[model samples]
Target: MTALSEYERLEAIGLWRADPQAQRRDVILSLGDASLVISDAKAGSALAHWSLPAMIRCNPGERPAIYAPSDEPGETVELDDEVMIAAIEKVHTIIESHRPHPGRLRSFLIGGVVLCVGAVALFWLPGALVDHAARITPQAKRVEIGRKLLTELSKMAGQPCTSPSGDQALAALSKRLPGHDTIVVLPEALMGARLLPGKLAVIGRNAIEGPDTPEVVAGYLIATEDAAAGQSPLKRMLGDLGPSAALRLLTTGNLPDSGITTYAEQLLRQEPTPPPTDGLLRAFRSAGVSSTPFAYALDPTGETVLGLIEADPFKGQPSPRPVLADAQWVALQDICTGR
Candidate 1:
C-alpha cells in the first residue's frame, strides 16, 4: 500500500502484556506495510506481528488507549503516542476502501474453479485416458484385441490362408523376422503388409507365392515394422474408436464390437505408405537383409525406388543368413492353395 509508506518507518513506545496474567513490559512498536511489529525494549528482539486491520482498541475515546489483537483479546498493548494511533487508523481506512466485497469475491472464485473443472472434463480427460489405457494394457490383451480386429478385417481381406505345412512355414518365417511374433498371410485385400497390435504382421498371399526369394517377403515385413516405428497399434485403434469406446475398454477390458468393425473397414480403405528411405535402410541393415528385391518389387524399373536400391545393405555382399529355408519358402508359397 503506497499510502502506508508515509508511516512505514514510524515507531512508538508501548506497554505490552503477553496474556491476562502476565506483567506488562516496555516494548518498541513499529509500523509495517500491513502489520504492527512489537519488540522487547531492552533486547530489541521481536515479540509479535499483529495485523493492522485486525487491531482493536479495547478502550476507545480515551487517553492511553488499550488495544488487543482481534483474535486474542487477552494479549494487549497500552499506547499513548497520538501520532502512531492516528497513522494506524488512517491505514485501516485505506485498507477498508480497497477491500472487495466478501460475498462477490467468494462467488467469483467458486465459479472460476467450476469452469476449470468442466473444461478439464470436456477437453483434456479423453486423450489422457486413452494414453493411460494404451500404456497399461497387457501384451496378452493386445494380442487378443489384434485377433478380434483381424476377425473383423477378415470379412473384407478374406480369411487367413491356413494349410498344415503352410502354417508351420509361416510360423518359421515369424520366428526369423524381428520386431513382430506372428505373420498372417491373407489371400487378398492387402498390398505389401500391415503391422497390427501385439507384434502381429499381416501380408498379402502374393508376397510369398509371387516372389522368387523369401528376402522379398521379409523386406515387406521389415518395411511394415519400420512404418509403425514402435508405436502401439492398440493406441492407434483406440484413437479411431474415440473417447467413449476407449473409456469402456479401460473399465471393461474390451472394446466395442461395432467400433472394431468400423476401424477394420477404415484400415482396409487406407493404403500403407512406406516409411522414410533412411529408416527403411536402417531396418534392412539391422535385419541383415538386402533391400534390392523389395525395391525392385515396388518399381520393376528401379527408377522410383532408386534410393532403396542404391542404399541396399547387402549390395555387392552376401546376406549374413537366409531369411527362410528352401522348403519353408516353397510351403509358404502354397499357403493360399491349401495343398
Candidate 2:
C-alpha cells in the first residue's frame, strides 16, 4: 500500500459519527500511514483511526459517499472530496491486486513443492519478500518511515539543536557536501554521524565542536553515506524488526508503532560500524576533502588508519576551497550552545 506520491499526507473535510445512533459531527479526515484519521475540526484532536484495508464504501458511486470500517459496523464517515476518495480507492485496488485469486489457487498449489524447495534454499521466506518490498518502496514512503523513526529516536536522543544562524550555516554546509542531506546536530546521545533514510543525517555535538576544520564533519558525513552503500538504513531497520514488520508495511503501508519504538530503543545503544577504508577514501576523493583529519580523529596516533593519511586526496595541498566560512564554522560549532 505504498501510497502515490501526490497523495502523501492528503487531507479532506468529512462528517463522522461514532455509531449508527450518534449524531454526525464535523471532522478533518487525513490520510495516515495506512489508515484514515478522523479528528475534531474545532479541537484538532484525533478521534478515531480507520484501517484503509478494512474501509468499506457503504454508498459506492454516490455523492458524499458513506464509509465505514468493516470491523466497526456502526461507526461511519461521509466524504465528498473526489481526490481523497480516488486516492483511497487506488490504495485499496493495489492491495486487492496483491491478494491471491481463487482461480489461481490450483496453479499455485501445483508449484507448491518447488516453491518450498526454493524457500528452503533461501532459508527464509520473509527475506525475499522484505527485499522485494524494499526495492519497490518509493522515496515518499521512505521519507515517511524515516520521519517516524526520528520521532521515536528523539525521545532518547533529545531534540535536535537549532538556532537561526546555526540552521543557515548547516544549510550552507549541506550544499557543500556531495549528498546535500538534511544535516541535524543533536544536543546529545548520538555517536559520530548516522545516516537515516530520506537523505537525512544526524551527528553528535562533538562532530562540529571538536573539529577545527569543517572537513572533519564533512568526512564523517561522507563516510556514513558510503557505509550505507552495502545495506540501506531503511532495509536494515525492516530486517531488524523481523518479517512481520516488513509484511505489515507491504500490505498496510505502515509499520507497527510498538515495533518502531522497540527498534528505536535498540538503535540508541548500538554503535555504527565504520565504513570500509577503500570506499571511504573514494568518497573523500569524490567530495574533494582530505581524509587525514578524519583518520586522525579516529586514532590520534594515526597507527591504525595510516592508509587514510598517506592516501589523502588533498595531501600536502589545501582543499579546492574551504568546506565552510570562518563565520559559518563558528555558528555551526555553537549550534547546541544557542549562541
Candidate 3:
C-alpha cells in the first residue's frame, strides 16, 4: 500500500467495459489506498471497485494497457494514461514482495521452535539428547541429510563417478549388502569405505582399481556396513554437529547447513575407523566373500592383517556365488577411469 501513498486519489480517464458483449464507455478511474475505483463519467457515481492486489495486466509491454480484476474474461479496463499503468505495476510489486510464500512461513515457524528447544538443550545432557534425536529421526529426513553431506563431500573429493554399465554393476553389488541401496564410488580423496545415513556406502577408487577382484570391493562394503551397524551413522553425524545443532534437529527437524558442510570436509581429511576384525570377518563369511584379497588390500606386507588371511572365510573352498559377472566386474573397475 506504501507504493500507492504518493498517488493517493489520483484520477484518470479510461474506457471501461463491464462485459465483453457490452459497449465500452468513458469512465473516471480513481486510485484508492488498496483499490481502483471506477466511476460513471456522467453521473459521478462509483460503478465498480477492483482490489489492487488482484488486478491482472492482460497485455504486458503494450501501450494503452488493458487490465482485469482477476481472470474473468468478461470485464476489463483499458487505460492509455502512462502514469496510471506505472502506478498499478508498482503497487502490485509492493504487494507481492510483502506476501508470504507458501511453505516459507511454516519453515520460519519450525526454525523458531528449534531455536527454543536448542536453548533448553544447551543446558541438558548433550549425549543423551543426541541419542534420542537420532533414534526418533525419520528415514526420509536421514536420506535428505545424507544427500547434503554427499554434496559437501563432492566439493572436496570431486563428484561421484557414474557410467551406464558401471551403475548396473554397482546396483548388483549393493544387493549383497542387506538394506544398502547406494554405493558411491569416489575417484579420489577418501581413504577407504564409510557408511552414510540412509543405508548409503561410499568407497574410494582404491577399492575398485589395481589387481583387486570384485570380492575385494564387496569385502570393503561389508566392512563399512558392519562398522555402521556397531555405531549408527545418524548418531555419529549428530554428535559431530554438536549438542545445540542436534537439539535443533530434534525439535525442528533440521540442522544448520554450515555444520553438515564442515563435517563433510572433515570426513574427507580423516580416515574412517575400522570395525572389529571378528565382526568384519563374520560379515565377509556371511556374504561368502574371501577375506584374503581385502586383507592384502589393507596392508600389502600382510603383517598387520595376518588374522584376516589366516581366518579366510572362503579359503580352500569355492565362493558360494560370484560377486559380479566378468563383464560387470570389468565395468566396475573402470567406473572411475573415464568419468
Candidate 4:
C-alpha cells in the first residue's frame, strides 16, 4: 500500500467479480492474519489468498488483481465508493509519513550489526560450534531433552492421550523400529517424535494413531532422528534456557541438567517451531519413508504436494506397512473407531 501512487490507491478496492461468479461480485479488501484473503461473500468461499507479511499492492487497481513486487498477482476487490476510495488514499499517506523513532532506528542498526557478526561466526567457525555442541550435547542429554519436550506436547494437544487405539498404535510402531527397546508414546510437545539416546523413540499418541497409514508414522520418526543427527537436542533445551544458559552451552559442553524439565513442560503446553528443510529431507529419505504422508499431514491438498505425489517412490512398489500384525492391526484400527 505504501508503494501505491495516489491513483493506484483508488483502484486497490473495488467490485471484483470473476466470470461464472458474476452474481457474487463483491466489494472486497484483503486483510487478517498472514493472508491477503479475498472473500467472495456470495460465493461462500475465499476467492483468492496471497500469503501475507511479504505482500504489497504493486500496481494498485490496474486490474481486479495486484501483486507484490516479489510475489504473484493476488485477487483484488471493487471499492468504487468515493468515500472508501478517498479513505484508502489518506491511510496510505499517513502510513508513509510515520517513521520509526531515532532510538528505535539506532537499536535496529545495532541489532543488524550483531546479527552480521553472529552470521559470520556461524559460517566462519561452524565446525567449532558443531564440535562444541557435540561435546556438550551427549546422547544421554538428548534423551533427557526428548522427555522434557513430550510433557509440553501433551498440554498443547489439549486433551489426555488415553485412547486404547492410540496406545496400541504406538506399541505397534515401537515394534517396527530400528532399535530393540521399549518406547512409550506420550503427548506431543515440539514435534511428533523424540529419539532418546538408548534408541528409544517417543511419539505423541496423535501422531501414530491418526487417520494415516503406518508410513506417515515412520516418515515422522525418521525425520526426528535426522534432526538429532545434526545437533544434540540440547540446542532445543538451550532454546528454553534463555541467553545465559545458551552462552554456557556455547562456551562449555554442559548446562544444568535440571533445565531439561522446563522444556518438557513447555512442550506439553505448546509446540516448538519447525526444523530446517535440508535436515527434514535428509531424515525423511534415510528412514525409507515417503514425503507424501507428511506433506498431506501438513496440508491435505493433492496439488500442494504434487511433486511429492508424482515422485511417490512407494507408488506401485508395495502396499503400505500395516499399523500392526494382522490381529494387532485389526485391534488397533478398532481402538479409535470402537469395536
Q: Is candidate 3 or candidate 4 better by lDDT?
A: 3
Tens-place lDDT per residue, model 2, 130-160, is 7877777788888888788888878888888
Predictions: Cα RMSD each: 11.3, 28.9, 20.2, 27.1
lDDT of 4 by residue, 185-263 (tens): 5543434666543355555656556734666656667666565555545554454466556556567645555565565
Candidate 2 residue 4 Cα shift, in angstroms, is: 79
Which whole-number lDDT from 0 to 100 does residue 129 have in model 1? 83
Query: What lDDT score is found at residue 136 in candidate 4?
Result: 59
TM-score of each: 0.65, 0.63, 0.61, 0.44
Which candidate, 1 or 3, has the higher TM-score? 1
The predicted structure with the larger lDDT, 1 or 4, is: 1
Q: Which rank order by TM-score, best down to worst?
A: 1, 2, 3, 4
The CA lDDT at 256 in model 2 is 97
Provide the clashing-pair count of each candidate structure.
Answer: 0, 0, 0, 16
Model 2 lDDT, residue 74, Cα: 88
Clashing pairs in 1: none
How does model 3 fare in lDDT? 0.85
In model 2, which range of ten residues has the least summed lDDT? 178-187
Query: Model 3: per-residue lDDT, tens digit, 1-339?
Result: 444667887889999999989999999999988889999999999989999989999999997899999997878999999888889899988898898797998999999999989876676679888889889999999888888888888888889999999999999988866767798988878867777888777888888887447877877777777776666788888888888888899788998989988888877776766778888888888888888888888888999998888988887244678888889989999898886
TM-score of 3: 0.61
